[model samples]
Target: MFSRKTRLAVAIAAACSFNQALAAEQEQLELDAQTVVGSADESAVDSYRSTPSSAATKLDLTPRQTPQSISTLTRAQLDDFHLDSVNDALKMATGIQVQEVETDRTYYTARGFDITNFQYDGIGIPFVYGNVEGDIDTAVFERVEVIRGANGLMSGTGNPSATINFVRKRPTATPQARIDLTGGSWDKRRIDADVSGALTAAGNIRGRAVYAHENKNSYLDRYSREKNVFHGVLEFDLSDSTLFSIGHTLQKSDSNSPLWGALPLNFSDGSKTDYSRSTSTSADWAYWDVQENRTFAELAHDLGNGWQAKAVVTHVKKEGDGSLFYVYGTPDRDSGLGLFSYPSEYQDENRQLIGDLQLNGAFALGGRQHDAVLGASWSRSELEDISWYDTTTGTALPPLEDWSGNIGKPLNDAGSNGSDFTDRMQSFYGAARWSLTDRLSLITGARVVDVESSGGNYGSDKTTKYSGEVVPYAGVVFDLTEQYSVYASYTEVFDPQTETDASGSRLAPVEGVNYEAGIKGELFDDRVNLALAVFRTEQDNVAEMAGMVGGRSYYRAVEGLTSEGYELEISGELLPGLQAMAGYTFVDITDANDDHAVTYSPKHMFKAATTYRVPGLEQLKVGASLNWQDEVYNGIAEQDAYAVVNLMASYDIDPNWTVSANLNNLTDEKYLTSLYWTQAYYAAPRNASMSVSWKY
Candidate 1:
């Protein structure tokens, strides 16, 4: 646990040292680059999407080529939209909704279910409810790909809603470099730099390095943060068909006086608007610090005979220390609001390891074309969490300076104790596709998974791992014309429940089925891509939150839950001088057991953006985007819908120099971005930023 004063001192020292090192490194790099000119393109999109020097598997396989629905967010889209974080990028995607829990915590949902499973370069990283941190930054990724429906084939035992994959940027055979600096309101400042080039004269080896730093103040009092990140990758071409890559990432973050829990919504009169934006209760002396390190290695081989093999291994370690403040109910809600308050301190450490292998190839059957894939994966994770609580007796007694020294003793009789948990999973799967004709295809897949968990304060017990249901998939794609196609697909997914009952028995896994039909087209000489899709999803044996009546979380099995939706999306270059990307979704989620609308699903969600270069000013480019979501209830209580507008402008001062500005929440709208059963969190206020970049 860190105190505010100590954390601030440490941050200052680190920043000073970092700046000195950066200056020295910049000078050295500049001198070396001046001696030789690089051939790589300096454009952000080109650099981000450059083909890997090492031969790798292509991601654009047809629905028939793969037994799943895959979606991608490209680097061009990220740059056009100015997406700075993973949360910012996902909100614009189809069939995905991101809910904000706190300033630093976010929850992801898809197909009317929460998505708790994630992967980096196809390596598993499991996440639990109570403890979530160490999120990866978008700066280090090349692209994001999502597999809709169940992904037991690769993720082992996990959520069926969706499986997210983040592809790390790898080094390129061509040399390139870029640097950007940004400053904005709330004393915000950020810098990002990327450099990549061939590591060997023969071009058999390449390497890439990226560094990013961000510091800013938040809307809440005494809330501020600083983050530092570094990413590096090396690639080697063992042969023309075989390649290997290794990468590592390190991140450190510090937050001043983070809040433990949100304030309750209602007062004595049961009115919802009883809280004040300026209300103060959190001790100014509290602080939080987090550190994360991750590394991975991957190898791929392409057998000229239409066969390919790939393997990946990854490991991650994270640790955190912090003090947080939580607000509780008072005896007299109307009169003694400040009398009831509790502060807690926590320390946590987590580590994970994962391995994956896959083989894919094409074969012929019954005079028709067929593609097949077989894969297996294993993962293990361990976590330790400890916490201490203090309860003060008076109603505003000591000053901020003395709060830490004159605190009460621990509240829990268990004293300063901790809990340790471990989770392990193994899975094997196979899938194949049959092309009935040049215009039609059939796809199917199945998987078996075994998962185990143990080691907690209540003692450890392992249940005989049960096999997951056999998932089946089918799809059809018809090429209507050179530029148009129609597709339909059905997929099934299952998610095992790790939570145990009072008798320590594992609950049945949840089952999900999805139906989808869509059309995809390319116009304007294959420059523009557009799609429209209608979809429906149903889940069986859904896990429902029962209640937390006595400080313990409880859940029950619900029979049926259903979600249906339609989406429209347009991407790629729209015109010679103009480019645009946009999407709209209409969702209707319901609790099939009661036929009531699901609490968190929005009815309408939309996003659109376009960028165009000024006719006379070739260096000037301007863009604007709109984001909106219809009203949805918070639990059973209704909340108002909200929308926000964002604007961006960039000017190329020269071929190697550029400047850009961005404005978010342009209207200064006040609305809740997300709400829990009894609480709401405000969206970010209107903010603006300007940045300068130089590339070589």
Candidate 2:
């Protein structure tokens, strides 16, 4: 971490340089309110103008005005591209890296670190753990926004990679309804319904509801999944200047014979094992299930003088239960005999509560008009897990005669254990954007955070608390012309570690400092946005898992890591009826000595997607996307570079009816999505889906 004196010096120098440039163009600049275009309503999904975003700075700033790299996957984009799940959507995003640790466990990384922060409707929430198989269904969301950099101003504790913000679908003043049915390969079936309108004739109360169900079988033998989602929201206009909204969301997921891990890659003889793409190592009895519920309320009041006060509260409860059978041990090339089955069952419950209150307004300061936001937030998350493992020693289950899909379930019922974890955080944060001139602006913010975590095995507990940690943020943006802007930003983040030093004393938290500079352009009346940025992130006290001590595993926090990367992105309407989005990323990460490289993250990635409507046949539209990534390395193996392309087409049969079809993995490229020391997970092959919809 940089010293306070150094940070201050850097900020002052950047401010002076930006101020000088602003003065040169002070006489020819004009500032106007950021564009507020049409809403991302249900029917309009192809436009790419990202405006009035509250995720990046909690202010009315367009993507071009925000200092960080931000991306929004709008409803149109999701629907047109058939991004059904959070994982699927993120894979199409630029500069994002998704790793599948297991069939159900996934992780997202950017700028060389894991993304551990998330939000819903501008409210902070616990990080989404991939092991839970909770995808945060998109049926209830209007868009998914991502900020790729440190965001400690609002997120109290996290990494510097990225923060995800989910914007919920809101009640509309106009009546609307839609229904859709879909069928696809593997006997996949899906149904969806959405309705929104004013509930009262006076137009003081509005409501929206969404319902969806899906069931599908996978290529893996005997594996199937079913999921359901329900979302409802209501808005009340308490008074002319006051509004209140309440909502509820419920989701359930169930899977049969789910695979815990991929098949082994090598045999005991050191020869590579070639398994079919449809191979499964899971027993017929293995299953995974999850249930989640959330209730939330928000109040907003105008405080006069262009100021507003808002308050939000949310409660979330989630339960996960699953049984897993893992296949281990290197097998003999000929007999396939050395493998052993380790069966386990687990159940867990997670409950969380979050509250936030903020005030925002525009004020005159230092002879300039400025915008500022002040907020305070509190959150608590509690988790409890119970697990049972097979401990029958001596004899193992009969060895497999052949690698077939049929395997008998084991019954051991030998050992059991439980654990509980709780996390609490309270923070006060504030930020202001000062318009030094019509063409120049300076943004700065800070957060004072206090966080604590307590948990342990059933019989013992340990508590760690971090207090009075202050994270600062600053940025400068200067408009070089009406269509071009350049900016620089610095942000800090801190992550609490569970590791202890050699003396058994817990080490200090991991510290990260991120530096970024970029250029932005807005063309065609701000309908098209483009950006190019270069960034470097420094980390100190990075923790690495070490050997066991005193019968318990620990970590060493003496390691240092650094990452440097550059990204170029373009998104918006390319023509009258054509929308396009494209991005390319390059990243390099190394250890303290700059020799050993980080694993699992690709060095180069490129993504492009476009949709075009027939100029005359306006009812017909076609879209396609291409995702390419450079080679990636795991500790045990390396995966060659690969590219996957997808195509989609939609035709409106009439004013109220439409049909769509999507084809994924058009080339049926075979590749590995993840690699472990002994196993490898392969990507799915070609698949197709078609849907029919009606709206009124």
What lDDT score goes with residue 380 in model 1?
Answer: 84
Best by lDDT: 2
TM-score for each prediction?
A: 0.85, 0.89
Per-residue lDDT of candidate 1, residues 543-650 (tens digit): 654433212234567777777777777766666557776778787777765575556667788877777878889799888888888787655245577788989899
lDDT of 2 by residue, 87-164 (tens): 888888889877665566666778867677778887878752312364557888888888888888767764678888
lDDT of 2 at 130: 18
Which one wins on TM-score?
Answer: 2
